[model samples]
Target chain A: MANLTTKLGRLQMKNPVMTASGTFGYGTEYSDFMDLSRIGGIIVKGTTLRERQGNQYPRMAETASGMLNAVGLQNKGVNYFIEHIYPTIKDLDTNVIVNVSGSEIDDYVKTAEIINELDKIPGIELNISCPNVKEGGMAFGVSCAAAAKVVSAVRKVYDKELIVKLSPNVTDIAEIAKAVEDAGADSISLINTLLGMAINSKTRKPMLSTITGGLSGPAVKPIALRMVWQVTHAVKVPVVGLGGIMNATDAIEFMLAGATAIQVGTANFIDPAISEKIVEGINDYLDTNNFSSVTEIIGALEI
Target chain B: MKKFILDLQITHKVQLNKQNVLLKLTSKDLLPEILPGQFAEIRVDKSPTTFLRRPISINFVDIAQNELWLLVQIVGEGTKRMAEMNPGDLLNAIIPLGNTFTIPTDKNAKVVLIGGGVGVAPLYMFGEKLNRMGYKCVFLLGARSQSDLLLLNEFEKIGEVYTTTEDGSHGEKGYVTQHSLLYNPDFNYIYTCGPTPMMKAVASYAAKNEIFCEVSLENMMGCGIGACLCCVTDTTEGNLCVCTEGPVFNINKLKWQI
Candidate 1:
């Protein structure tokens, strides 16, 4: 049987089916519809030091087959996550990965150190690709030097498996991916929301409070796939791909493009249970192909 | 997660005039407890232009038959496609979403119901529960024109019904507030769902009269529940999510746009 299990450094996943950060809010939100235990792991909502109120009205706008968001990490901070979100989710059957976002290097290190102290947290996903904020957002992930700096800084205190999420809004994503890889990142996730905009013709103003927002959903799948392929070849670290993946076919497409795992975003806005569907679809695809596990299919595509 | 295709069979489709379609649906299993002012995010797949799910207020819920009803208008591609659905076609729907109308109490009694446009549908469900419990009910309705009036007869069958239309084409010949304020009777608690303007008007009137009123807000939502934070209502308690904190809110608890 083709074994489906994969590892990010020391941690092992039953399957390579994971939920992306920002899109999957702490995993418990979707528990009402499906069992949380079935998913491989969940990279929960982004967190910071203080409570984040996020951007204003029209946080999301629809494009052809995709949507844009400027929800500037609106969440109760790390302390609140420890007290509120973690207690409930930590007991759940799945791996709980915290998606950490920050303005400074300490914010990143402190967040990672706090999660390391927690009992059930599996990993820390550093989000250096948020274009909506004014400072230290995607700037870190876009520049290889900054990416390596943040990666090394957080790596010093993280203690556990550290995944550096790469920003697609960059001149060369593969360079930053390699930088994080060299900085001791266990894995790399690609293509956070792309910077995009919308306009209200009558008012002649931008639709979102911020003139620009991050784009996600099915529209960016092709671009995200391209990045995943590029970064997968550039770095030895495992790659988790996301950006508008709505179904199992989309997930498979990423796997073919060199991503070892896949994350479901935007689709959560449309169908809350799509991840389960994607999981089922993957299992079905594996079973029918007579492949013993998902590992055989990971980067199985022939050039 | 049980990934069963929710075979949402359309039991009945009534085209209300030309603007709206009332789609009555039934499924295999019993639905969860759905309250007034709460909505269902329906996957509007009837046409290509309307692929995203349309968030429709829960107009009515028939618990006995495991069926639900939605009063949707042709505001966009979603509602327009929903209008064309027929019997036997399945429309994937997620129900009992968002916060529902806060019924008077843990122990119920006097309750007043209010409606405007398709918003009136949810009131019917609350009215049904109230009437069965023998709570004294008063209904205040608002509409653009007499013809635009929906479910008035159904509401009248449950309680005393009052109405107002902008063109003087119906009962009160004015806004619902005009009539509600004029005959401002003692309501132990009130429930309302309607256009934002109408609900705001009702909420303010209720606030001024010192009446305990719960108004359901309508916001453009991607998910009927609280993942997107798409549907939010600013309150005295900061930015409270309309999807969770309420699609329904107490008039006193709300911070109006004014």
Candidate 2:
């Protein structure tokens, strides 16, 4: 049997397949469909210090092979999560990570400080790449200095594995990845949704209420792969590849391109069991190829 | 509250009109307990444009025979593909989703159901449950023409059925809002699911006459579960997940202009 266990800084997961933040609403939502314990990790939705109602109606629009969303981090704040959501999911036999977001650095730090008190939460995927929110989401993500500042501030309070999620809307993604690493980031996950727009040509109005939103799904996979490969080489910290991964083949490709782990995002909207299926497929592929451990294939691209 | 993902076999497909089809599917496995107003999400395979599961309401369920009915309209590519399926074909569905309509406390109360276009799809199950429970049911359905009005006989088997066609080719010569049966709001309760204009009108009339009322919303959704924040309906309590919190909501909770 191949060893599928992998690590993100101090955090260790049984496998390399984890659901991306915001896509998997806590770990409990999919418990009826698949075994939550079989998956490597679960990154809950984008949580903030205070309850955010998010954007207005028509938050999602479907495009060819992809979708745009402006759901503006509509979570009920971290306090609700710790009090209500945590007790329900903490007992699940899997790594439950929180995806923390904020409109200000203080919001980010305070949220992390509360999560640090929880023993069940293994890590947090610091979200500096949310494109839908007006304030701190993509603002800190696009610039090296802002990215480093958020990471540094949160790193001071959050003792767990800190995975800095980077935005794809920057001029050079690798530069931003390196900045977070220097800011004491334990790991990096890249290619958060690319900003895109769609117009209802008949009505001559924008499809999403935010006018422009983050684009995700198979349409963004190729670009996500390129960025993951670049950032994996640019920083010494482990890189988690995401953006538009749909299936096991896509997950394996990300791992081969140098990602130690891969997160499934929009694909969950299509198939709730996709993350579990990808885990099974990765094991099957490793066995078929005569590989002894899953880590042996990381960054093993022949080119 | 129990949910199941099952591969159900298509037993029959009855085309209601040029636009709608009634699909009867049976499962060999013991079906999970389901209530009226809940829906199922069916995956559309082999279609290029449809990558997401289409959410459809449960129209009828014959628990004795393990039969489930889905009323589908050819709204887009996804529904178009569902309409073309043949009997004996297998369809994977996630079912018993969302909350059921609140059954009135007074079983003897007079109740009315209003549906607009394909929005009337969920009323069959709602009417069936009410009829079997001995509640008085009055259905007011709206469509474009005589052929556009769906499942009149099925609803007739359970309650008093009324319909209005845009072309006036059916029971009433105007919209459902103008139906004579609706003039008196002395009913104990009213339940509605239909076009926004019709629902707003019904909510307005019900509110004015002090009739307790509820309306089902047809918001465009992704992941019929609450995970995706795509399907949201604003209420007095704030924005709630239409998929989990409701597809059916009391009129008082809704922040509609009426």
Candidate 3:
């Protein structure tokens, strides 16, 4: 009950726990088991200007404690989201962060421009980090100039809060995280997925059609934690950290590492209700320990 | 529907015929939402070494008692452990996922159900539902050996059943296509789910004959939904998430990667 209520930049969340995009599919599919309004926010699947057909067979491959995917940014497109999915999710009490992806700068700006016209949607999480597609994805997020260019273009057209989702596939996350910060991003979300692959071994053929894909789950946790710590210090803006966050303990570790908020990604693949369970777990930890608000715990770890 | 890490208590595990095991599960409120062909991701922790969840197709559901059946073939570590499960042991299953076979609008016409390998699981359920609804149904099931044939008596109860095995071990020798050739089969629609090669063969035969056919696909899935984009199939429209766009697809609409 204490500091559980928090702010990820200008966008306020009832709690820091939110569903990562592509995991909680526009927030209505899991309503059978989870109540939508209870959690902090929902980042719907990655959106594009045109509906993406995605990749070929075996687009996903399972790894040690994680999975690799090359889904190729498949969604109903921005226009479809505004018509079909938005009316269903926008009015819900939780924050609806529209995660927009694009193959070009104009595509992102156009997607953001359409989203800005929506009434109840609070912010836009620019997904420059998707690794599966043939187009922009990591190609944009990995370069300093490219990162700044995309962010700058969207910032000009969209006045809403901008959260730049950073890709772990990059060489120096801190440098690129700072580039987006200078480009006028309101917050940073670190460590989408570490690029990796798994092979069938017997057939001697590649496990995924893409041959390589985005790696997520607990296998990427440690590296993600380090990146969150690195980027948080490099940028002045708040950071939203996500990668293999299974429990409240894992989420708190990210918060201590300087993430103003956090998103639970691959964990939902195993358990649909994990976000609510994590929200409850964090609340219990704060209540029993006499901590007031979750925001106070953000970066509370002393050196 | 609510997806749960359901602890399905295996009530009876038996080698029903051969190379085939029938599991009777006592799960609460699971059958109400579960349909045929849609699978459950099972965490077979018979031991930690094979800890990853295994995907298994649902055979049938007895809604009245909430009893579920799975026709499992020993393929890998996950399934071998599943075959060894006892009456009270629980297995974690994420059920009613992907999608189900499309039901035809014409309840007045005859329907044919085709299945291959353990793909028979869903066709059996589909036949059961359509049979109860007053539609005429013929179920064709094929396997490699007589030992591979499963649930013959069960299918007999639902509708007219036909069987075929590769080496002449059962009712009709050769393939399910032999059964298809014999009957005027004058069917209004056909529904199928099986191994890739088998479905392709059946779809090809159906296509040549100009009979309506729909097939359920099996793919390696990370997330059972569209997110991971792992379960994909090449089509005329391009590529699609088999889990969401379909684990069930109209045969004519699908551009099978032959």
Candidate 4:
């Protein structure tokens, strides 16, 4: 049997198939469809310092192989998560990682600091790459210096496995990844949704209410894989690759491209059981290849 | 709030018009109680463009036979592929989603149902349920013409049906709200679903007369569950998921332009 265990700094995962934040709500929403404890980890929706109503109506638009979303991280704040959400998920067998988002640097630090106090949560995935919000999301993620500033500030207040999620809307993604690594980020996840948009010709208006939105789905796998490979070589920290991974084969491709772990995003909308299936698929691939451990496949690209 | 994912086999497919088809499907397990205005998220596998499931309102449900009905209109890649499907083919669906319409409980409550275009799908089930409960049911159905109007015979069995065609080929001329039946002040409750403009007009009229009204919204949805905040309809309370909080909501809850 192949060992599916994976470790990123201090945090360890049962498998490497974590559900992307925002796509999987609070870890409990998908309990009706599949077992939450079976997957690697569950990253709850992006939480801020205060309650957010998010963007206005008509926030999503469907494109050719994927969809565009401007959901703007609509959560009931970090305090709400501590008061209501944390207790329910605290005892779940799988690792519970919180995806922290904020409109300001202090909000990010405060949210991370609160999550750090939770005993059950082993890490916080710093979401510096959300494109939908009007301020401070992709702004911090776009530049290497800005990315390092947020990671270093949060690292001082929180002492858990800090995975910095990177945005693809930049000139050089590997440079940003290295900057976060240098600033004490435990690991890195890339690339957050690529910035894109669509237009309705008949109405002559932009499809999303926000005019432009972050794009995710099968359309972004090649770019995500390319970045994962580059970032893996550029940084010593582990890389969690996620873009438009839909199935097991897609997940395997990410692992081969040097991703230490993989997060399933828009694919969860298509199939809620995709993360579980990916875990099983990874085990099956390892068994077929006569590899005793899943790590052998990481960064195993022939090129 | 029970949810079931079933591989339903197509038993019958009837092309109602140039754009619409009535599909009949049967599942192995007994279906749970499904209310009027609730919908099923159908997975369209054939089309690459349709990665997310399509939310279609339940037209009818036969508990005894474990049969389900969906009225699909060929409006996009998903429905276009669904239209080409033949009998004996399989369809995967998540069912019994969203909230139901408020069933009239008062002894003297008179109800009117208004539907436009493919929006008329859920009204048959609503009318049938109301008819079973001994309530007076009336319908104001709108279409492009006599040929565009669907299931008048099915609706007539449960209610007094009135229709309007855009080209004046049917009952009353002009839009559904312009029909003479709407002018009558007898109805105490109004239910509407269809094009946004038509529902808005009906909702406005209902609000003006102080009648209880509800409208089912068909927003662009990703996950039929509340997780993906994609299909949200703005309401007085906040932005609520159309897939969960409603496909059915009282007009009072909705903050429409009217």
Q: Rank the candidates by TM-score, best first.
A: 2, 4, 1, 3
The lDDT of each candidate is: 0.79, 0.90, 0.82, 0.90
lDDT by residue for model 1 (A1-303), tens: 346577756567877778888777778778777777877889988888777777766676666677767777878889999998888888887778998888887888888888889979878889999888777778888888888999899899888878888889888888888889999899998889889998978889987888998888777888999999898989898899898788888898888888888889878867888888888888888888898878777788789
> Please, what are the lDDT tens digits per residue for candidate 4 over residues A237-259?
99999999988889989999999
Q: Which runs in model 4 stand beyond 4 Å of their true positions?
A: none
lDDT of 1 by residue, B159-182 (tens): 888889999889888888788444
The better candidate by TM-score, 1 or 3, is: 1
Pick by DockQ: which candidate is best? 2
DockQ comparisons of all candidates to the true complex: 0.34, 0.69, 0.47, 0.67
- In candidate 1, the residue pairs with backbone N, CA or C atoms under 3 Å apart (3 or more residues apart, or in different chains) clash, namely A2-A292, A2-A293, A4-A294, A4-A295, A217-A244
Candidate 1 Cα outliers beyond 4 Å, as residue runs: A201-205, B1-5, B46-48, B105-111, B180-185
Task: Report clashes for each candidate as comma-separated counts.
Answer: 5, 0, 7, 0
TM-score of every candidate relative to the true structure? 0.93, 0.98, 0.92, 0.98
Q: How well is each residue in B1-258 modelled by candidate 4, as lDDT tens digits?
A: 767778889999999999999999998778778899999999889355887889999999977778899999999889999998999999998878898999887957989999999999999898899998898899999999998899989999998999999999988889998999877767899999999999999999999999999999999888888888888877887788898899898999998889
Which sections of candidate 2 miss by over 4 Å? none
Poorest lDDT segment (10 consecutive residues) of candidate 2 chain A: A1-10
**Top of the candidates by lDDT:** 4
